[model samples]
Target: MTLGMVALVGVGVALSARRSGREASSATRLGLAVVSVLALWLGATALLASTDVLSFRSARPSPWPLLPLSGIAALLLLGRAPLAKTLLANTPRHWPIVAQSFRIGVELIIFAWHQDGRAPNQITFEGRNFDILVGLTAPLVAWLVATNRVTPKPVLLWNVLGLAILANTVATVATSTPGPLHLDWPGAPFTAITTWPVLWLPALLVPLAVFLHVMSLRQTLTVPR
Candidate 1:
């Protein structure tokens, strides 16, 4: 895993600790803390593994399904309101929706920069530069939930866009081939310029994060109000 993953765990912990004080809902409070702990353990540790610092070569940024998976689980722990309850409930099927929102809100900006009528080296949109922005936005999303933002309606909007992005990613994943070259893109076979853990990002971290997000969302929506 990478230090970054570990860092996220710490961040999750801090967020949970803060929530515990402000959150009146037991479920939300517990979810926040638990997800924080998991993030510290699995997600952060895997990151160390991914970068070789920890030694799990196979582990990457996402580390088995922790990112969104944990995010969603954390969301559940955030407690229940009205919209939060609704959004959280269908998160299983709607998992992809959260992904789409993240892509559109956080990723579409980067896509515009790179998708300028040419294929860039990066495979997944989140894998490209400025993706650090996604890291920023997502935390804010979580923060909003923790703090009660301008209502989940906006989150729902972003969730729709996220779902769209998820579809695109799935399509891209299907089109991708692991060889000297690929079946989808007929030109270059493989290039380091584009291989900065590009495809691996979505395949590993994204699905995991998506699952977490969905789980969190479901929990947030379902907790008895």
Candidate 2:
């Protein structure tokens, strides 16, 4: 399921780039390079977890390496606005927003994790996290925008809401984890996110989601109605 989501995101980006007149070869190469690097990093993290080297329950609380990496990527994407905007401009304005439908699957996975007691309830829909609403509404909002029923202002508001929801979930998860920033919880800490497959949530999916929101906002704010 994780791989499937990752593949969808990668394909969406590559296809959009190609449609925007980017060289197919260059886009493909770039996509492959990114996938390869992430795959290797995930593999290494999984191996370390299996060896008990990345245990969230440990005394030191194994660091989530991907957090910093994703942060850096976000900074770069935001800092290099001209380059990012140029690439985003070529793609269909609605693709990034529509692609967010993948979050529905992510929410489902979170529910499963909650059922298994791997994740704290605070991060689930039954708790403080309302991210599922964003996932459920993404397609409708995207359609509205594409058909001209909705203006960029509404889309901008939706993106802002989505970002807020994402930020809340991230903060909840971080505080629930067994780390320096961890908050005291009753039953268990968020150990599952430190392991395989789930690790990709913070490592890849979150970063991609954030990028989509940022780019969509940039497009909507800068482009004329």
Candidate 3:
């Protein structure tokens, strides 16, 4: 389900970049961007999972490779804007300062919930809430910006919110356990809301949601330098 969402996001990115002012330039760059990021992520995920120091969780380390890779890919995409200046042309994705600031805001929000009392190592209601928040915010913000309903000025906010959601989800998975036990019809609030699945929502759904949001952000929004 999540992989499907990630693929959908890829389509969104392709479509959105095509409409940008630097269409021709973005074409080559976007290809390199996606392909390069994928290669890096998969390659790294395989190598690092066996390492002892960087080990994330004891249960399922499969997604361990994805966390850092995704984080770095996003960080690169946000940071390396200047390199893509020619590709951006009128629709500049330039938001270096804004992106950094947004990332900080998102991180603070993630950590804030921890300040009161940390949830268990298993699935967290707090973490799922963040993913849903980004899922709602990213697409809407993308639509608003693309339609000129809002300024391209808040690109940083959108990206920050999006990536922060991803980062924090990964953080939770790394620290929490899968809680080997399962309950039946527990009348959990999350079950009523349909946000909580059996296992932690972190690895199962959040990655795909994060990618979907990014893709939606690209497809629904068009900006210029």
Candidate 4:
């Protein structure tokens, strides 16, 4: 699932760059840089997880929480960078919204993890996480935008709702995990995601989701009525 999501994000960026008005060489270089950055980010986070640096269940000054928080902050800031501005100006409006369809796969993986006893029920769809709804509706919303069947205002509202859903999922996961923020649930504390492979969920996927939503909103808000 991690690899698949990573690939989907990378491919989406590459395709957008290719389809944009930029010169072919420039687009290729940008795409390669994006993929390289993603690989490096994953490698660094994986190293921290492998060395137990992120497993801070008992540590007072834990780096675990700060890692994802800082990552999310950095990604949000990146949305305002010149490169992001150029990409947003040139890329198709529907692409970012459509890309969010990957969330369906992520929700499926989380459900599987819950059934395996690796994740708490509280973070599953049967419990507090209804993030799957965003995934299910993303494609239809993208189609509406592509065909001009909906106005930018409604699409902007939908993106805001998606952000809200994402925040709820993040809160649920944080509270369920073992830490100072941990809230007791029916089953064991959610710890599997703090390790390698699954660590990418918070480090990469969630932040990427936010970046896409912000980019979509940025584009939608700029469109003339």
Candidate 5:
């Protein structure tokens, strides 16, 4: 799932670079540079997780919160960069909508983790997390946009709802997990997320999903509807 998230980011970066009006070679280099940086970042995150740097006893404040916070900060900064602006201006508006389908896999993994007893039911589809709905509707929304059956207004609304739901899911897990913000809940704690591999769910996957939705909103809002 970690590698898949990285690959998805690379795809978005490559597509954006290609459509940024740069020459093919320059675009390819730009894409590679952005993707390489993200790959390296993920590698470091994974290493930290392996060393138990991201995890701690359930009674203590987990270092895991820092990972998602840092990732979100980086993404926000990146979104303000010239490259991101160019990408928003050039990339097809529907691309981000389509890209959101990746969340299906994310929810699936969470569901499986819950079943495996690694995660809590409160963070799964059967629980408070309804993020799977956004993923399931992504294809339909993209198709509506493609067929001109919906305007940018509707797309923007969809993005807003998606972002809100994602934020809810993040909140659900953060509170349910063993951390500074931990909230008491029934069943097992969501300690699996602080471990290696699974840590990427918050560090990479959630942040990437956020970026996609925010970028899609930017693109849709600026369209000459």
Candidate 6:
């Protein structure tokens, strides 16, 4: 599922570049390559988790998942540098925002995990996480931007809202997991997220969602008045 979403984003990026009638610049290529590498690394991590090669069920000072999460965060911070800013600015403004639609799938996966008794309800849409709304409305927001029916201000606000939801879920997942900061819950903690496929939730999808929101906000804020 994660790979499919990554491929979709890659296709969107390629199509956007084609529609713009310009070849991808070196920086754009580099950015895409970096994302591709991260996706591959996440896939490998999932495979390892599936085989029981990596486990975070026990309470530890620092879980192995934190490594990838921190790496992704570092990459996002680096993306804010001048070169990455130029590459992202050259990309279609609507692409990143549209990419957020994948959150719907992420939410569905969480729902399934909850149903299977692997995840807690607190992180699912049925619980405190309202991130599904952001995912569901992503297409509409993208359409508004595409058709010029809305100004950058509204999109900027939407991005901020999306970011907040993303952060909320991240925190929920972190605190709910069986880690040093885990909360004492009645049912099973969020151990599934530390396993196969679901691991991509924090390792890859969350970071990508954050990157999209940040890039969208930057573009929206920099739009000419």
The TM-score values for the models, in the order shown, are: 0.41, 0.85, 0.43, 0.93, 0.93, 0.84
Q: Tell me the spans in candidate 5 whose CA falls farther than 4 Å from its real position.
A: 58-60
* Tens-digit per-residue lDDT, 14-83, candidate 6: 5554455556574357447655876777767777677644576434443655655775687688777875
Tens-digit lDDT track of model 4 for 71-184: 789888877888777777878899899989889988998999889888889898999998999999999999999999999999999999999999999999988887778887
lDDT computed for candidate 5: 0.83
Give one digit per residue, the lDDT tens place, for model 1 in 116-188: 5323334445442333333445556665655655365566554444445555554443334233223555533
* C-alpha lDDT of all candidate models, in order: 0.42, 0.76, 0.42, 0.84, 0.83, 0.76
Q: Write the per-residue lDDT of candidate 3 for residues 1-225, one digit (tens) a residue.
A: 333333443443454467654466666567556655645554454454345433323554333434545554674475347634332342323212112223233334334434534333123434343544553454456555555676644764666566775676555444443232223312221111111212213322344344444533453355453
Tell me model 1's lDDT, rounded to 2 decimals: 0.42
Candidate 3 residue spans exceeding 4 A from truth: 1-33, 36-40, 43-83, 90-129, 152-158, 177-225
TM-score of 1: 0.41
Lowest-scoring 10 consecutive residues by lDDT in candidate 3?
189-198
Per-residue lDDT over 13-107 for candidate 5, one digit per residue giving the tens place of the 0 to 100 score: 77777777778777777777877888888888888877756566545577787888888889989899886888778887778888899888889
Pairs of residues clashing in candidate 2: none
Quote the RMSD, in angstroms, for model 3: 10.5
Q: Pick the lDDT winner.
A: 4
Query: Which candidate model has the greater lDDT, 1 or 4?
Result: 4
Off by over 4 Å in 1: 14-149, 179-183, 189-200, 219-225
Please give the lDDT score for candidate 4. Answer: 0.84
Please give the distance, in angstroms, between residue 224's alpha carbon in candidate 3 and its true position after superposition: 10
Give the range where candidate 1 is weakest over 10 consecutive residues by summed lDDT. Answer: 187-196
Model 2 misses residue 219 by how many Å?
A: 1.2
Candidate 6 TM-score over all chains jointly: 0.84
Indicate whether candidate 3 or candidate 5 has the larger lDDT. 5
lDDT of 5 at 120: 89
